[model samples]
Target: MGLSDSEILMPASGADAVRAFGDGRDVTVFAGGTILMPMIAYRRYPQRARTLMLGRAGLNQISADGNVAVGAMTTLAAIAGSGVEPLAAAARDVADPEIRAQATLGGNLCAPPSRQGPRGDLQAALLAARAEVRCAVAGRERIEPIDEFLAGLDAEPRLVLGVELERPRRAAYSSQRRPHAHSYAVMAVACAELADGVRVAAAGVAKRAVRLRSVERALADGAAAEQASAGALDGLEPQDDALASSWYRREVLPVLVRRAITQLGGG
Candidate 1:
């Protein structure tokens, strides 16, 4: 839906934007409005855009501790162009070229429907990399788990400050889409730097994006990527979409997981 109405609240910085969400007005935080504008244009939202955009400060800064700090409003183009290896590669694969140029990483993470499913691109990528989406609520607070927060999107009016993709160590994201980033049939991310060795997670196949912790453990123990059996699709419920069949998704997941892990330098 388009904005629910109100005034424009563009804070001086990202931190300032976090504070505004506390005001309790009907404020829907905006970054690039890539998702917001398109929905509105197509009449998905009934009201006009609201005031109060939480600028770069809330989720825009890239921290030096190795994690990429993206402001809630940081456009997808920014993250895609950040030159931050893993994240950059993922961005390069986002839908079509035009969408990537205008969409914000914040918008992609915050809007799940637009992202296709919980197991889609950004969520699965961050989940595997152990990323944290810093958010602000009630009384000057900060939250990290974007997954937990996203689960309850239907229930609250919370604001997304920005997502912090923690320290990167050889990582890669892969997905099954129709030749572009329009959406994903199956999306996977494999990383070797989070804890010890590599971990894999798949989105676009089920709810909450399925993490192959089991496969990760196997890899840590030195199993080759090809050794990642169908077990990699464990704990998932693939869905049928206009793009592909559920069966097709189930069949392709293991391969993608292997490719991601292997390419990231994992066995």
Candidate 2:
């Protein structure tokens, strides 16, 4: 399948994008297009689908005060250079300079197929940082926690406007991948400070990137970092593929968790 007659609509503003999505027939929102281009070429997505592109949509801005706000079209490269700690660290590991320059946070969040496998790396890092997604559909705006938003990706009609997060006091992200910047990690862990205590999230170890609440509980109870990490993979079913076997992922998950926790000043 190829994009022979695929309709491409370039919206001039965010409001226009929302309007275009509302008329949806199999709409795929194109931001940076790094993720979508491959899906189109591989016939993973319908070849004749509608594509709502975020061009000149005023969604590429990044601003910060006490809280940080990143527009949906903001490039991964910009985020990597934004001095945002763990998020920046994770973005830096996404790919080489070129892909990063063309990848958007919104695309990454929504690109992953809604099934079992390694999803987006930023999802876990954002989860640990307690980020919120701001979105809209047909003039109706919605604001929700990042985790909840991710869980309902298929059902949500809202297009992501931006993400919001408070600046973290301490944060870190780690992943098991080849030294090559473009390689997909078998597992990734992120740790950060929260108002209540420390929070931890991991990617590539389950159907989707998720928080390790069991590990967070262990840390809150003052357990040793090694002990907390050792027990963290209790319920996760890490997948196996060409990059790594399932057992290898399970074995390395705890180590990544420990290192991330240590980096966050928790252990």
Candidate 3:
């Protein structure tokens, strides 16, 4: 079957913009155009983006101190070159350099789920930083926990502003890519001094990026790297792709987790 499409709505401010989300509305929100543009060209998207909201009513606004509140249309390049969390650096790890220049954090989160390594980077880093996602729907604006916010979301028609990753005591993210420049085969983020002893999240391993609770519990019991990782990811079956196998992810995940935890003074 083929597809048909209609109009584009341009929003000029944040308040009027975030309220545009609704159910049963076949609309595509445009940000850096990294994900949406290419998909449209290839005719892969099921819904037609009718309203091209062309304003930053809700996309642009960094807090006076350091908190960032970006409208759904913020771009990755903008974040990469800024003083935001090092996730931007992780995002820099994304392939298609041109795409990075046009990718937006809001787009990355709200867009369809991707298996690419960068998606993990954004989610994990944000989780580490205790990020918050602000969403507007049903004529009401509300903020949701970053981790909980993204959970169970299937990218329905909703207006998502850029994220806010609060400053952390220590946080780091690393990715292992196949050819070095291609998307990461496995990505890890370790956060310490966070409410939990250590929160480790990895992407590109399974259907959704996961936080290593076993590893966290081990560290809580004052375990060292060897014990922490050995128990944290002991028997999980990671998915295998062209770039890696479940065995490979299991092997490297612990090492990276150890390093991240160690750096945060967890070990």
Error of 2 at 34 (Å): 0.9
Per-residue alpha-carbon lDDT of candidate 1 for residues 66-94, written as tens digits (9 for 90 to 100): 65676656655666777665666667777
List model 3 lDDT by residue over 1-267, tens digit each. Answer: 243445656666665565554542666666666666667797765566565453455475555265555545556666666655546655666666677766667767765445432354466666666677877665567688876776746654456765665555566666666675555446565453554455666666656566777877887888987778676565467777655777887788777777777766667
Which model, 2 or 3, shows the larger TM-score? 2
Candidate 3 error regions (>4 Å):
1-4, 53-58, 64-71, 115-120
The per-residue C-alpha lDDT of model 2 at residue 126 equals 91
* Model 2 ranges off by over 4 Å: 23-25, 113-117
CA lDDT, candidate 3, residue 152: 46
Tens-digit lDDT track of model 2 for 150-260? 888767556899999988888989888867766776788998886778889998877678899999999999988888998778888877766678899888999999998
lDDT of 3 at 74: 56
Model 2: ten consecutive residues of lowest lDDT: 110-119
